[model samples]
Target: MELIESYNSISESDLLIIEEKIGYQLPVEYKLFLLQHNGGRPVLDGVRYENEHFDFVGHFYAIRGEMYHDDLLRQIEEYKDMIPKGYLPIGESPGGDVFCISLKEPTEGALFHWDHEQANYDGEPWEYNMTKLSPSLTVFLEELCVGE
Candidate 1:
């Protein structure tokens, strides 16, 4: 996927701090993407959720963007309990649902979507609450297509 508009690059030191604060090693492919384009829209529009498709990837949070909603670190903490354990918020649909990366064994680096309407923040993630977007971030980018 291509970044349409993005912020400046993040230094390795800053990235390290982010990792430390978040307690997970950032995916390498994602780190490369961040170094080139901290946050922005993918050229390919909407992403598919199960059989339903929505505005692909409207926006991603920058490592240190001025906007609260577009701030990566901020979103991480805000959505911490909203998402399953080890999942990191990376982007979102135009409707405000979240796209995240699985940080656990077996699904590490895989992309997932948390439906705002279906999720239960107080409970464990159920199949009804989550959809596997792609096996990996690379594959997710590859599957992206223009929105309606």
Candidate 2:
């Protein structure tokens, strides 16, 4: 995946380090993937960063995206089954108090989640589900700096 930069701030070497940790070469094409698919939030310059880490309705990220394996989807399912009803099934980071997300049903989409009454931003709409997802997300994220 090609990386979108916030100003020429991040170097190839820095991305390489991230790649080394993730063990998958980020295809050059994926930079657009991060921008279009991930997020569009700007930093100091007009540049923006889209992390695969935390993207919940609230909270700032200590780390972005998760490093996980293929099995995590199943794990999320198992975790979902454990949800106590009424409350959302959320994943917590071992690092600190972070934004948590809900366990989505298979029919939902991977949008940035927000409660119905909460404020909305001018971005992609989110849903309250992720159950019908492909498995690579877990592995793709597991190599990144995510925690939960």
Candidate 3:
């Protein structure tokens, strides 16, 4: 994961605050990643999804930021109604698709892609939309290839 731009590493207190605000304990690996790289674009990034290469992961959002565009906490609140409850936005694709993690029990910490076009307002996010990207954020990063 070659970061194009990164923010300052956050302290443990910040992480705790975020967990409290989000109402769920973040996955250990993801919390560590955020501590190292608060937010940034990944260079030459591509991940395999259903046998197809998706190079659309443009940016990972910061926990909170002066720049409204990079504020993950705000983004999560903004998209709360649009996405299923307990799902939080962690990153975005170049085409504006959202990448999230399910906070619901039994499926907590699972990575998912929330496709706008395929969304169903009345149904659960995982029903006919929201593709599972990886079992965990750690695996997702590990599988992301630094493209040529």
Candidate 4:
């Protein structure tokens, strides 16, 4: 996938610090991606899943940057309670939906789309709000297509 407007490159150590703070190890390919691209807008921004659902990625959150809205750490903290455990918000859609990665087993490394409108913040099970997007971040990037 092609990415543009990426932030300043970050070191593996920076990722390690984030992992420690988040209390979960990031997937291997995702870690490499952060080191190389940090975060940026994908040229082929459209993502499709569940046969018909579609959305365009706005921007991926970055690790080393002054853009607070696009800061990975800040996004994580902001969505901690909103997002269910065992997942981490890494980016967003223009309409405020979040893209997250599964951090625990049985679904580790998997990517998901979290629909904010359908989210449950009242301690109800959130499985209904999460739609599996891809088996892993690697596949997710490869599958991104140009939006019409």
Root-mean-square deviation per candidate: 2.1, 14.1, 2.3, 1.7
The model with the greatest lDDT is 4
Judged by lDDT against the true structure, how good is candidate 2? Answer: 0.29
Give each model's whole-structure lDDT: 0.81, 0.29, 0.79, 0.88
**What's the distance in Å from true for residue 131, model 1?**
0.5
- In the range 51-108, model 1's lDDT, one tens digit per residue, is 5665468888789843667889999888877777778889888888888888888888
Worst 10 residues of 1 by lDDT: 47-56
lDDT of 4 at 8: 90
lDDT of 3 by residue, 72-106 (tens): 88888777777887777888887778888877777
- In model 4, state the lDDT of residue 147: 80
Q: List runs of model 1 lying over 4 Å from the truth.
A: 49-55, 65-67, 122-127
Q: After superposition, how far is residue 140 of candidate 2 from its true place, in Å?
A: 19
Taking all chains together, the TM-score of candidate 3 against the true structure is: 0.86
Give the TM-score of each candidate. 0.88, 0.24, 0.86, 0.92
Instruction: State the TM-score for model 2.
Output: 0.24
Model 4 lDDT tens row, 6-91: 98988888988998987778789788989889999999999987655489899998996435789998998888888888888889
